[model samples]
Target: VNYILIDKFQEKFGSAIQNLSESSVISLELNGINISRFGKLCWLQVSTKETVYLFDILTLGYEAFDFGLRRILENEAILKVVHDCRFLSDCLYHQYKTSLANVFDTQIADVIVRKEEAGGKWPDKLRLLPECLSHHLGLPAAAFQKYSVSRQPLEQASATVWTMRPSHSALLHLAARHMPELLALRTVLLDKLMVPFTIHVGHSLDAYR
Candidate 1:
C-alpha cells in the first residue's frame, strides 16, 4: 500500500485519478472518528487491482476531495465496492456535498444472501465486516484477532485517535489492509448472487442507493 500525504498529493493525484478512471471497479474504505456529517474523516483508501493508495484526509482536508477524488466517487460509470455505505454516504454527502453513485454494498448483499440461505427469513441483526469476511471469505479468527489488536490501542486512546497528526503505522496498515479483503468479499458475494434462486436478492442490493 502506498501512503500518499499532502506533500506528494499534487504529484500523484493526476496518475491516481487516471488509473482509477480506467478501472472498471475499485474498492474503498474510509477511516475516521464517528464518520458522519458531524464527525471527522481521517483517511480514504482506494484500491484497484494493481495498487492500494491511502490518502491522508485529515491533512489534505477539503483539498483532498476538491481536486479529483469527489468526481471519481460521483461517477456512475465506475462501480465502488464498500462494506456498508450508509455512514460513508452520509459523511460524503453532508460534509463534501458528494453523492456516492453506483455503489455495490457488501453488507447489504451479505444480508440478502444470508436471508436466502435461511429460507427467506431475515437475519436477527446486521453482520459486522469481520463477521461477513469470516462467513463469506473464511477469514480466520486469528486474523481478526490480529487486526483487532492493531486497532485496539488507537480505539482505547480516545475518539481523537483518528485526528492525530502523523498517524501511527499500525493505524495506516489497518486502513490499507481492509481494501483487498473488501474487494475479495465483493467477488465472493457477487458469485453467490448469481444463482438463479438468488436473482431477486441480487436485484435488491441496489436498495443501498
Candidate 2:
C-alpha cells in the first residue's frame, strides 16, 4: 500500500487519473475541508487494487476541474468504489456541474447488507468507516484513531496545511492511508456480504431502491 504523491495536479493529475479510468475498477477516497458550506476538496486518493495514488487537489486550483478527470468520473465503464461519497459527489458537482457514474458506495452497501443479515429487522446500530473496517477487515482501531491527530493543531490554521505538510509529516501519513485501507476493505466486505448489492442511483443514503 505504498503511495504516489501528485503534487503538481495541473500537469500530472489529469493524465494520471485518466489512465486510471482504463482499469476495470477504481477505489477512490477523497478528503476535504468545509469552507462556507462547500467542500474545499484538498486531497484525492485513488487505488486500483495494486497501487495507491494521492493527489493534492489544492495544487490544481481551478485546473482540478480538468475534462480528463471529469471523463473518468462520469465514465460508466469504470466502476468506482467509495465510502460515503455523498459529500464528495456534491463537491464535484459544485465545482464542475458534473456527477459521478458507476459508483458503488461501501457505506450505503454496508447498511443494506447489515439489514439483510438482520432478517428484515432494523440493525441496532450502524457504523462509520472505522468501525466497519474493524468489524469486517480486522483493522486496528488505534490505527484509525491516529488519523484524528495533527502534528500541528489544524483547528487554529487553514485546512490548506494538509497540503503544505511534507509526506513524512504525521498528518500526511495518517490521511494517505485512507485509500489503501479502503481498497482492502472493499474486497473483504464484499465477500462477507449476505445480500446482493444495488448500485445507488445518485448520492442518496437509501440505496435499496
Candidate 3:
C-alpha cells in the first residue's frame, strides 16, 4: 500500500508534490518546506493528553486534531491489551509505540544526558529532561519538575511548546519509511544502548493515582 504522508506544519506544506513525468519520482521544488519536526515534538510533549481527550469526546461533539485518532491505533485490537490513557492516547492519537518491550528504561536510573549545547545551556543531568522543558522552565541541571506542568496554569505556554513537538524520526520516516540511515539510528538509540539516554521518563498513572 502506498502510504501518503499528510504532513502540514512540520513539512509538506500546501498543495501538490510535483516532478513525476513518466517516472515515479517525487521531487520537491527548489523551495520545498521541510516539516517543523522540532515544533511538532514540542507540541506532542505538551498537547497530546489534551488532544487525545478531545478524541475520546469526539462523539460528544468536538473536533479532533486532524487524523490524530488514526495514529492512536492502526486497528482497535491494540486497544484491548492496554487500559492506561497514556498508552492508548499516545499510541493512537499521536503514533507512539509504548510497548516497553525488552526495554531497560525501567531499569536504568544512574545514566544521565549532559545538555551542554550552548543554546539551551544547563548542566547535563537526568532530572531536567527532554530539552524544551529543561530550558524553558529554567530547570536546574539536576532539578526535577517539583510540580507538574499541567497542575500550574502559568507554565502552560512552556508546556504547549515542548509537548507538541514531534521527533525528527517520525517526520523523516514519514518521508521514507525505508530510509536506512534513520532506521539504523533509531534502532541504535531508541531500540538499543539502554536508554534513560537524554530523556526522562515520567511517573506512571498508577503512581500518581
In candidate 1, list every pair of residues with a backbone clash.
Answer: none
Instruction: Say which prediction, candidate 1 or candidate 2, comes out ahead on TM-score.
Output: 1
Off by over 4 Å in 1: 1-7, 149-157, 197-209
User: What is the lDDT for 60 in model 3?
Assistant: 14
Every model's TM-score = 0.87, 0.77, 0.20
Report how far residue 76 has shifted in candidate 2, in Å.
Answer: 0.7
Report the C-alpha lDDT of model 2 over 121-198, residue by residue, as the tens digit. Answer: 767765667777787778777867755455224423546565565545455555567666676777776765633433
lDDT score at residue 186, model 1, on the 0-100 scale: 93
Give lDDT tens digits, candidate 3, residues 60-176: 111223333222223322211111123223333333332212111211211212232233355444431223233333445443333233213323443332233242344322222
lDDT at 100, model 3: 18
lDDT of 3 at 193: 34
lDDT string for model 1 (148-197, tens) is 66565644455577787777787677778768788889999988877755
Residue 9, candidate 2: Cα error in Å is 5.2
lDDT of 2 at 57: 70
Where is model 3 poorest over a 10-residue stretch in terms of lDDT? 45-54
lDDT of each: 0.82, 0.69, 0.25
Worst window of 10 by summed lDDT in candidate 2: 194-203
